[model samples]
Target: MSAFPKRDFRASMTWLHSWAGIIPTLLFFAVFWMGTLSVFDKEIDRWMQPESRYAGPPIAYDLDASIETFIGAQNGVEVTSLFIMPPKPREPYLYFYGVLAEEVNGKTYSYGRFVGESNEMLGEPQSLAGSGFIFPFHFKLHIPGNFGYYLIGAVALAMLVLTVTGVIAHRKIIADFFTFRPTRKARRVTLDLHNLMGVVGLPFYFLFALSGLYIFAGWFAALPMQTVDGVMGKSPVAFLELADSQSPKRRPRAGQSIAMDKAIMPFKTQAEALWSERYGAPVMADRVRIEHYGDANATVIVHRVFPGRRVTMAQDRIDFDYATGTVLYDQQATPATATRSWLEGLHFVQFEHWPLRWLFFAGGAAGCILTATGALFWMRSREKKAGAQPFNIRFVHAMTVGSVTGIMLATGVFFVANRFIALGALPPGIAPIEWEPITFYIAWLLSFIHAAARGRSAWMDQCFFIAILSLSAAVLNWVTTGDHLIKTMTTGMWSIAGMDLLLLLTSALSAWSAIHLRGKARQRPFAVQGDDPALQPAE
Candidate 1:
């Protein structure tokens, strides 16, 4: 049955879009903001860890040396897997990551270390920083286990539905693309801005939502897997083992340690040549993985980093026998696998193209604006219907103010906390790596409290606070690291310099937004109009 009058598909869709969007707008905004930042998570890592600013890729590119260093550092620890990631265009330091057999509180953990060009350990902060904190937060919001993944997957599904309904509802949304009236009434302006952002960013928003859902298809498949398992009397573990049996098996470990130099010689000599010949480009491996390092059947997998390519990070791989360096298996993606890889690449923006990365960032920001404004529009329309705002309206108002402004404040706090943790200025017993999320949650909670207590002024207050915190973070980096913006830019250390510049830019933008919000609050009476028009769409 039609939700509205017959032939009023637009009206029905409008109602569906509004309610559906408002339901998950805040969560959607958080995902969009974090996902956008994650596009440059590696650059952010370089910014966070100043010791990693080593100009460019190491000239020697010694995988064996890095692996040896890692093994020495974590002596006596049984490593389950070892990965060596050599520096590439965006990442300029050798990174050695491994999964160890050691269990902490019944949970296994992974450790990553940074290696300088000289094959020596670089003392960088032992924090997740951007890649660890921000990137995962994008998909999971740091929710423990599969819950976060399932939550994000649900949100992605909702986003897809909302996008479709929004398109159907906004019959003249294309016309609104070129029609933005800033001087109009608050309600009209918010509506127009929301339409503008939604229409302009439709393609990006749609693809992001679809790709995100596709990425987490495993979570969505769990229920069906259980059903199939129950019907077939098969366990997931057994299925996994059956699948693994097709791959190369690890032989018994040899008592004597394998020669690292001899193991990687084949990769260093012929891996790149093979990849370049196959891909028709001068592809070079940036990462290598060695399984069963000391075992008779050790395997070495080399991964190529293809920069400035399309949204398909083929990352061509070739596996070799550790002892003989003979080709064991070359990863060749099937058509369906290649399509999936391309979609994943599109969402992650792994290809090294700054312009495309910036465009994706902008599109994500626009999605955030769209979500925030949509929530505010609902509040405004509700207020217009009733002379006074109800409990639900006020609650949503506070939530909108808290979440939208709160996240920005929390991000600023996270950056500042990173610097403090790096300088050892934080209080005792607070591990720098763990303190990031703590500081973020604390700031976010305070924003909610301030939003409730201070009412409408909280937006302006938090914006101002974000500006201060952002500026302070930039200044702290300069003071602590001595990597001033001017010096970094002059020396062509863009990783650090670009981050500092962005922080300052964020500060300026926050200050401007705070001032604008303050002016708007003063000019417009809180209850002058029946409509609330609580928030403005951001540029």
Candidate 2:
């Protein structure tokens, strides 16, 4: 009844790993690549938004003054909540966001404005470019609604299964870790690379997949909560209230007799004093969230900044009664919540440890390489089949080349378009924030078309295109902003300079890859069979 013997766990797992991974691996690659880029998201934000750039050191600003100005500028708009994000090392500008009381067409929306150290508004163009694009795209795939969340969650579950089965299938995983033969045939080389990256980065891959699932556990599986509710004979709302009793509660505004400025200033002063007394240092508020503004039940939550100390960002917080400026809650997270926070932090790398963040990025890239090569290896293995290439095989090959290299090319186009928008080269109607994604999708669609038309040559052509576009982005930045690499280095503008340097480095690597692919293409022409002596496996 079974294709393999029941006793052969390895064979069964090998089959499971191969087929289970084939389809989802493409999605996994996109997620890994985008997630890797998101590590330096704040820095990229600075690169794209020149108006928010600050060349000098971090400065302390008056939070009260900024808040007062922001409120005054609201022009009688009823704001339900306000958030103030202070400047940090990479993000050197204060940001103000307000949630409006009224919804736009039944959907609630928040408005944001950038503030300088002097508490003056910096009218930076409101665009969801740079890190904003890549960050959400990583988890959501830019898909609308909760469907993207569920879809990515399913993929994460599949990845978890693939990791477990992969471990079982590779019995000699340790040996394979040290066994890559570059001189072997193309298929062997691809397989070896796949094995090497997978084996070496297995722990990272497993943790990321597991943590991602846990982070979205609610969306992935509601049965656990449902069971709890059923057992207790309680509604979901009541259960949620019990679970989140420690969190701040939201309430409607009471329209009490309290001046907005008077209500906010005392809380700011007390929060700073309390934080300094507790941490033995002056507290720079990373974030200040005020809910139910002007209401008797209003609450203010102050989140402090402490970088590189732990995995979790904003672990410390102080809550206050908005009207009286009295401390309401000053408790740390419970052990259970702390553990969950740590896992979430590990996945996000919100802590400011540069070296560890780089390690995460490298590991994520390794995971992408592992997926890409696995697909390539599968395609190569089937190329030796006797009959004509099957439709499924061709389809997989087209998708492999298109999605893999297409993403890179599209990313290049995104950078170039960012520069064009910033320089006002685009049409006035085409907003920078909106056009960035538009350009990316158009380029990506064209890449798929090219892949379908050119077959194997698509790889080389896309790589070459990526090289040119990458270099162009760096050049464009310098020409438009007059912030050349040498000037940025001399002036200590590391954020912009670092991004430019990385772009150049990316261009070089892409060019090298293109040349290497060209040589390989010439040496072994595209074929559906490995019967040729050149395609023979190395002994």
Candidate 2 C-alpha error for residue 33, in Å: 0.8
lDDT of 1: 0.74
Candidate 2 has its poorest 10 consecutive residues by lDDT at 231-240
- Candidate 1: which pairs clash? none
- Could you tell me the lDDT of residue 127 within candidate 1? 63
Worst 10 residues of 1 by lDDT: 231-240
In candidate 2, what are the lDDT values of residues 1-539, reduced to their tens digit? 55544656777787777777777766887888888888878777877877777788666667677777777776676776777776777677777766666654432334445545665665435445555788878887877545666778888898889889888877578667699899776777787888889888989988999888887884335435444433221221233323333355434457774556564556666777876687687665566778677667778877663444578544567788877777777755556676777778898777778789889989988988988987887677666662474676677877888778888899899888888877788877876668889999999889888988888888999999999999999999889888999999999988788889989988999899999999988988875333444333211
| Clash tally for model 2 | 0
Candidate 2 — which residues are off by over 4 angstroms?
Answer: 1-7, 103-112, 218-252, 263-266, 272-284, 304-308, 313-315, 528-539
- TM-score per model over all chains: 0.88, 0.88
